[model samples]
Target: MASRVTALLLLGVVCFGFAAAEIVVDCCLRTTDKRLPLQILDSYIIQDAGKGCDISATAFITKVGKKLCVSHHSKLAWVKNYINILDKKKGGHQ
Candidate 1:
């Protein structure tokens, strides 16, 4: 009975460790340089490199509920403009 209790405790710790690791994993491993139309985008989330991610990125959610990760350093100015548009939509100046 003692051994069975120890096995269950070990299993619980292993499961909790896996769950914790999943929480910190980066969302975007690769980013796209392609520019998307603002009309299709529903909103955007900024993925900070400081928050366990390798690179800073913008994950845009489309109207149909799809996520598109884009590089923050894309040469085109449209990405920045789109972010501004999204901010304005949320009534935020930043």
Candidate 2:
């Protein structure tokens, strides 16, 4: 019984960690959700470019039943903003 409890506890911990890594947010928006084209992992590696959550514009595309990772030096917020701006400006490549 103790071993079963321990195993369940470990499994819960792992799942919780994955859940946290899979989603990101803004001051008023959720950028990633379960039903999206991408699943984002936690990105904590930055070259001290000064604060306010610097992330990469690129995202790691892990297909179903496959493993993949992508690395890039641009913020996710920047990408969202750029996308919004382009969208608002009647769809031009910026």
Candidate 3:
């Protein structure tokens, strides 16, 4: 019985270690070209390629809670304008 208890404790430790190592890193693997209405957007998160991601993107959150990734280097004027608007809304000067 003592040996069984020790085996169970070891199994638990290994399982916990695996669970801890399964850290989910949310990164945008691709970007969308869809020009969504600015009114539909609620907020945004800027993702950096240097920060565990392969591409730099802007993750825009829609009013209904949907995430749309767009390349940070996109030449679309509306995309930049929307980002600027969101920044201002969040009290960021940019």
lDDT of 2 at 35: 31
Residue-by-residue lDDT tens digits, candidate 1, 1-94 = 9999999999999999988873656478788888888889888877877687777888888889888889873544788888878888883221
lDDT of 3: 0.78
lDDT of 1 at 38: 82
lDDT of 2 by residue, 2-91 (tens): 999999999999999987773433221113322323223222222221223354323322323332222332445544443354446445
Question: Can you write out model 3's per-residue Cα lDDT over 1-94, one digit (the tens) per residue?
Answer: 9999999999999999988773438788999877778888888877777776888888888879788888673656777888888777773221
Summing lDDT over every window of 10 consecutive residues in candidate 3, give the lowest-scoring window: 85-94
What's model 2's overall lDDT? 0.38
TM-score of each: 0.65, 0.30, 0.63
**On a 0 to 100 scale, what is the lDDT of residue 61 in model 1?**
85
* Cα RMSD, each candidate: 3.8, 13.4, 4.3
